[model samples]
Target: MEQLFTLAGIAIGSSGLSAIVVAILNHHWAKKKNSSGKLDALVEAQKVLMIDRVRYLGSSYIHDGEIALEDKENLAEMYQAYKALGGNGHLSTVMAEVERLPVAEKR
Candidate 1:
């Protein structure tokens, strides 16, 4: 009975040690995985929004020149898409955060 208890304690200690090592390794891996350029999706999305802002100015009366009605229509579609994506105002904070992320890295 004494020998059996010793063996069981050794097994439990090894199991705890193994679990700790695996947890440390997983945290390291996760940190690296999130560092990829995955965040570019958001950056590119922001870039697209900035361009549409310009288009909005050009198409609406803001430019003082009447953009072709077709151009105006296209601008509307862009605006709608922008709105669907939480809109320019909603992304203001997100854009700031995205800008902080390394342009070469992901979120």
Candidate 2:
């Protein structure tokens, strides 16, 4: 009877340990998956910011030809960043259209 109780206790302890090991592994895998997704989300956010900046700059240029030197540099940087992050060609198209628009004097 004493040996049977000891065997049963060992079995229960091992079962609990197995469950803990499985939990830890599951948590690690989940964290790994989330890390990849989080990076993608961050890149997507950067793309959105750059795209908006490009649009705003393009519109300002089209309306008034009022882009400052700093803004022009920023537009170029944003375009490069957008392209690096898998942006479509919409920004290039918009910029081309803006270029074709007649320049206006700044108010």
Best by lDDT: 2
- The residue ranges of model 1 lying beyond 4 angstroms of the native Cα positions read 6-14, 17-29, 32-52, 59-61, 88-107
Error of 1 at 58 (Å): 3.3
Candidates in order have lDDT scores of 0.58, 0.81
Per-residue error (Å), model 2, residue 99: 4.4
Query: For each candidate, C-alpha RMSD in Å?
Result: 13.0, 4.6
Deviation (Å) of 66 in candidate 2: 5.8
lDDT value for model 1: 0.58
Q: Candidate 2's C-alpha lDDT?
A: 0.81
What lDDT tens digits, residue by residue, belong to model 2 across residues 6-105? 9999999999999999999999999999999999999999889888888987887877755555556667777888998899987987677565665344
The TM-score values for the models, in the order shown, are 0.44, 0.62
- Where is the poorest 10-residue window by lDDT in model 2? 97-106
Candidate 2, position 77, lDDT: 74
Per-residue lDDT, model 2, residue 16, is 100
